[model samples]
Structure formats: C-alpha cells, structure tokens
Target: MAAFRDPLAGFVPDALVLVALDNALSRGWPDAAVSDLTRDILHASGIADGTVPAPAFAALLGDGRADLVARVRFLRMALGDLALGFDALTGDLPTFMDRAQTFGLFRYDKAMSDTAAARAEVRPWVDYVSALTRLEAAHLVPRLPGNAGPDWLEIGGNSGAFAAAICAARADVRITVSDLPAVCGLGQEMQKGQDRIRFQPRDARKSGWAAELGARDLLLFKSVLHDWPDHHARAFLTEAVACLEPGGRIVICERGPFAAGLADASFLSRLANAVFAPFYRDPSVYEGWLRAAGFAPTRQTVQLDMPFHVIEAVRA
Candidate 1:
C-alpha cells in the first residue's frame, strides 16, 4: 500500500481507533460519503448545525487521493473518536449509542485550515502536504516543452513535493516553493539534493507577494486556492497576474470544484475548522477567476483515476 502523510500520531493510536469498528464493508467510499454519514449522526445526536464534537478520523483520507483500507480506518476512527454522544446500542445503528462526543480528541483543524495563525503551531498530524508523495507527483505539474527553461513559482507548495516532481521530470527549470515559514523549513529538508528546487517563505493570504517575489515564467497552485473564499482567491489570482511577467503562465489544480460557502470568509473559515473538511467548485469558476485576473486558459482533468482538475492560463 502507498504511504500517506505519515504520523497521524495525534494523541491517539491507529489500533485504538480500529478496535471501535462495528460494521461490514461494501465498497470504497469517498470522503464525501463519510462526511454525510457523520453529519447525519451529528444532527441525530441533537445538534442541527453541521459540526463534529471532536476531530473526525480519516476525514482527510480523500485528501491523499487513494483509498486507505476502503474507508474502514476512517469509519472505525469515527466510531472510536466521536463515539461519546450517540447511544451505540440502539436501533439500526450497530455501534454508537449517545452523543458520542468526546473531549481530548486528536485535532488538526486549527493548523490545516486557511485560518491557521502561525507556522510554529503546526504539528506532525497536520502535515497533509507530504501526502503528495503517496501520489505520482509528476502527474500534478504541467508538461512543459523539453527545451523550455521555465522559472516556476509554487505557492503553498508545502515540502516542494510538486516542485521536486516537475524538476525530476525536466532539466532546464528552476522552481521556487513558498509556504509558511515552518512548512518551508520542512521543505528545505525534503528538497536537499535538488539545486534546481529552492524554498521561499510565503503566506498565500498575504498580499504583495508578486511584487516581492518578482516575475516567473510559470506559477502553480496545487490543492491550495480552494481553502480560501472567492475574494481572497480572486485577489491571489490578481496578484499572480502581477507576479508573472506579461507573457507568463498560471496553473491551478484542485480536487474538484469548490462549493462556495457562506459569504463571510472569516466565519466560513471558522466553521470549516469545526466542520468535516471541504468540497470543490467547477473548473469554470477557476477559468472565470483566471479571466478576471487576465488570462486566456485551457482546462483539463487529470486522468490519474482521481478527480483532479487542472486549469492553466497564459497572460498575454
């Protein structure tokens, strides 16, 4: 089996989570499936708002792009982690009996979301960026011409996984990866040998990155933009237009379309922290954003047996 981000060591043990399982499996389910069931349980337990009492397990298995034990680990972790509120012994339900809401649950919500405050607080369990290693990272980047020497900028590219992938695939490109300071620190280690790939500290939420970072031949945002509201996303794209030279290219890849949530991003971000991860918007949304930021683009879906959408725009 492929490895995921590693170190789910979030104050809980993998075995301890599995022991709580009380059901049979049918087929591999997506993260959306688990999110819905958990939502139902949360509501049935008397909470109408979509919220989990504690951190949900395997909530991010989908983020890794492959099935980890056919969602068994995710389900079992749910049964184990959030088993305090609901009454586990009643009705058609096989396990949960009460609210099943437990305190002291493993929580990565704070560090993983767009609302994260500082890089210092990020823990091992929140290192979702390395999850890219489990995937063929090369497929995530655009296929540039063999002789094209591109200066690439990867925003929020934690650990420079994508940069390393593309650099291995090409010879003439120099890539700079930017993320939170601490994440950049981690990337510096993961990106030791490749002189072509370097680490630069950047926060996507901040402005003026384009002015400070200078121009690049290509800019890539993989699994990054959807974490923000449309406005911030728009601003980032707008900034990208300035960051790239007049004829540069911008590429954005996300799992699926972002279902634009509540208008208030701060509130939505806070809600997201306590909610069951995220979803997506259509590729057109990104196309529109790209157009608004000044680019004529082409879109393609990654044929990697996963729901990855790639949008590329060249500033003219």
Candidate 2:
C-alpha cells in the first residue's frame, strides 16, 4: 500500500485557512503557546526561512490572532503519541456513530423533520468542498452514459451546491437533488434561479424514491452513504441502481479510511476523522456494495492528498 499523504502538506495559510485554524485553536490552547508554535511551524515548513522577518510572524501569530498550538499538538500526536497507545482513541464505526448520536452531532433525521431552524443550523460544508472540486467532477461527466444530455439525480444533495456545479458545467444536463422535505426546501431556496437544477423531497433510505424522476442517466452520491452502516449503505446502492436507466451510471464521492496513515494531515482533518471515524469505511467496502447492487466498476479515483475516493460504476 502507498504511504498516506497529508491533504495540507504544502499548504500556505491563506485568509480562509487562517480563520478556520483560528476557530479551532480558540477552542483550546493559550496565546503564548500558539505564537511559539506558529513560529516553529512557519520555520519548519520553510515559509519563514529567515528572510520573512519577525514582524511578519508577529502579524500572523499575534496575541489576538488564531493560535497554531493545536497544529503543533496534532503533529506531536501523529508522530510520537501513537506509540503511547493514542490509536485507542479511534474506535470502530458503530461506536463512533453511537457516541456522536449521544452528543447530538448526528442529527440528519432531526434536521429533516420539517424544521427550518434545524436545517439552517446544518451548514452544507460537504457541498462547499464539492464545489471546490467542481472541475475534477466535471471532467467525469463525459464518461457517463448520457453525458451529452444527461438527466442527473443527486441523493441527499443538501443545498444543491454540487448539482449547481454540474449544471453550470454542462448546460444540456438537467440535475435534480433528492433529499428530505426540509432539506429539499432549503436546497430549493439555495438554488433559487438555477433552471437546470431542481429539488425534490425524498428519503434516501427507502426504495422507489426516484419513481417520480423517471429513469436517470446519472446518479450522484456526494459525501453520503458512509453515514450509515453496511446494510443501509448497501440498500442505498441497491435503490440507486434501480433508479438508473439502461447504461446509466452511479458516482459516489466520499472520504474513507485511507487517511489513517496520513502522518501530516492538518489538525482540523485529524479532529474530523477522530470525530467521524465510525462513519467511514475502506474503499473496498463500497466496491463490494456496488458489485452487490449489480453494477460493474468503470473507474475509481483515490485522491493522493486526502482520504476522498470517487468510485464510478455502470448498470449492465
């Protein structure tokens, strides 16, 4: 197996990155520690190779700014803490999911209960990430069955950002986002003026959700499926396959277990994985599900820097 690479390996802190880092740091760690750690990381990453000057570092890591101590701590944990039984912190998927539910972190069902406030609180960060990868996703469109004029259906597409990206790239494609009624309403509001994209209320766990959309040429599952256990994930694939037309394709993009070995992953990435470990599986698990759903794999792309995997399969 190839060694895992860090998603933020060569990342230079931009404004957004700094803000996010700051937010994470503010949760813990002192200002002095953060400043010292920021300087150390900057020097080590070669971003402050003596020529950058001390005032620049001061500006970036000033007292009121977000601290980098958490990042330093993550690096230490990734390297040395594993030897001290830190790996025990990561439990299997079921345990993690149970703990998350107990803490009210896994509340998709609640958000879907026709509550606008709950839906509003659920930020569509997954779709934002998808939008960032829009070009890469768009490149796969031509490989699908009806690329010239595909009828697309996205299951659990919150806020319709991914669908909007597809529609923006391919004018001939008509994309529909299927989610719960509350989520669909939020999506419709988010995509108010996009004619190529539409929103429909449907539960993904149930079969025949796609009956109203007729046969779709391409089915998309972005950052979904891993939320459920093996049985539910398989059922989702089965239902998705049933919704597809002859020669139609299914595309699943999600983060999986490939990041466990990423020694240099960002602190935020490590924290997220730790929190959601139970919801992720290996790529092979998804391949098995697709096979069981009666689809043959056409392409698979594993991101080198992150744990994200894009698996595309075709029906018959």
Candidate 3:
C-alpha cells in the first residue's frame, strides 16, 4: 500500500543521490561526509519524488542510533541553508517579473493561430505569449466591471490578444488596439476577421493618440508601463485618462512582483532591460505616477504562473 502511494521511490532515490554528489563536489568534504550527505539527499529526493517508500525510509533512517541519521541531518541542514542563501543572491520574484516584462521574454505570442508556422519556424525561447492568453482569459478580463459595448481601448497591445479575448467573450465591446506601426501590423493580422476589433498605429504618450483613439469606457495599458520610466509612464497615463469617458476606467496589466520563481531571475531582468528600460518604472514608482495622473486605483489583483498584475482605476 505504501509502495503504491509513492511509486516513484526509485527515481527519487536517484535524485537524492545526484544532490549528494553535487554537494560533495562543491563542498570538498572528507570522504565520509561526502558519502553521508550523498546518501541523505538521495533518500530525501526519492521521498519527495514519491518513489521512496516511507516505510522503507523509516526502516533505514528510523534507527536514531545510526551515524547515517546524523549525516542525513547535516546534509539536509547544509543543503536547505544553501538553497535559501542562493535564493537571496538571485533577487526576489517581483523584481524578476518586472525585468521579464521589460525584456520581452514575456512576449506572450508563442503560437498565434495566425502565425503558428512563423512562430514554430523559430525554436522556443522564454516567451510569455501563451501565458498572456491564459491570463487574459482567466484573470484580466473577468475583473473588468463593464458589461457594455465598443467602449475599450488597449494601449501597447502587441498582437490584440487582450482585445481579442474581450471581443470574443463580450461581442458588444469594441476595442482599438494601439501600438507602434510594426506591432500594430502584427495585431492587425491577428484581428483580421473581427470587425469589432481594429488596430491603430500610435504612441501612447503622444497627444495625437487622444483624438485618434478617442474616448473609451476602459483604457487598457496591458504590460506597457514597466517598459518605461516614471515620467513617461505618467505622461502615458495622463493621455489615457484624458481619452476616457466620464466615470470610465483605465486598466493596467503588468507582471506582478517576485512571482516568477527562482530560475527566472536572470532571464527576466535581462528581458526587462531590453524591452522596458526605456519606460520601465518600479511598481511603487508607477503607482505614484498613476496617482499623479489623477487616477485612483480601485482594484489590484495578482495571478500565478503568468506573472500578471491587473490594476483598475477610474478617472478622477
């Protein structure tokens, strides 16, 4: 029964063996210490992997009288502390997400039905396009308050996924996805059949956008601000707020802080500098800019796996 519950004991035992090997290699411990820690990590890994039978572990390690127990204890303590200390060195998840958003690693366009061949032609990178689709469907759109039509505008919409999700779910709502010409072109292709969705080539911070995009019930700045500095983010927000109708709302979706997990820090930070260094502002700094632009945040939500944050504000 115990074996059935944790069938992967063999695999886990192997992993613990590897960790022990790596630790031994790094620490240069004496032969005995190396052997002991190796055995413990292998045992623990096996347990975690669900391959090690708990009863077997008890039979082996249960005898507190053995030196093996002491060795296992030392190995666990050393490895756990090492993991925490390394984590500290890597920086936190929020910072990493901010960087990811900036760097375009979160490019979120992995496989557009319209461009699957093109995307597939290139091998996988750490793009976040698929994740974005999920977030738009699950978290970002549902939180939106309006049940109205043709009343939304998306700033920094790269491929119209957000607008597409909105139009797909709520047929009445029309959104103009505004971005630079190249990006708008891609989005235009993506939104081809949907008359309710249109692509406009425009910059968010510029004045002409107001007249071009016109008033909207909701202005969406999805994952754009972190690519900018504070002043620019403020300027963009000011423009967006101006183009909103009275009692209208502006929704900003971004990568939530410290949420991406450990392996992503370097990838995320590098990505941020690439795509968002021009406009990326820290979340706190961006919050201040939003207030300065005369918008008060009414709601903020965090979503997992996709590294997303949705902030809804009303024009004040």
Highest TM-score scorer: 2
Task: Write the number of the candidate with greater lDDT, choosing between 1 and 3.
Answer: 1
Q: In model 3, what is the error at residue 195, expressed in angstroms?
A: 1.6
* Candidate 1 vs candidate 3, TM-score winner: 1
Give candidate 1's total backbone clashes: 22
Model 3 scores a C-alpha lDDT of 0.54
In model 1, what lDDT does residue 169 have?
A: 71
The alpha-carbon deviation from the true structure for residue 227 of candidate 2, after best TM-score superposition, in angstroms, is 1.0
In model 1, which regions exceed 4 Å deviation?
1-126, 142-149, 258-278, 303-305
Q: Model 2, range 37-148, lDDT digits (tens) per residue?
A: 5545555554443424245444444542312333423333333323333344353433433434222433566556657675654434323333334423554434344452
User: Using Cα atoms with residue i matched to residue i, what is each candidate's TM-score against the true structure?
Assistant: 0.59, 0.66, 0.54
- Residue 230 displacement in candidate 2 (angstroms): 1.0
lDDT of 3 at 304: 35
Give the Cα-based TM-score of candidate 2 against the true structure.
0.66
lDDT of 3 by residue, 1-316 (tens): 0111111223333324535534543443322344544556645654322323246444543432233322333334334433444343255544444433122223434322334454432112212332234334556677666643358888877667777787777867888887655556566665689888887867566676667778888888877777665677777887887787888887777765543422443332232222322333335555666677777775565433334566777656
Candidate structures ordered by lDDT, highest first: 2, 1, 3
User: By the lDDT metric, which is better: model 2 or model 3?
Assistant: 2
Model 3 weakest 10-residue run by lDDT: 1-10
- What global local distance difference test value does model 2 have? 0.59
For candidate 3, the C-alpha RMSD (Å) to the true structure equals 13.6
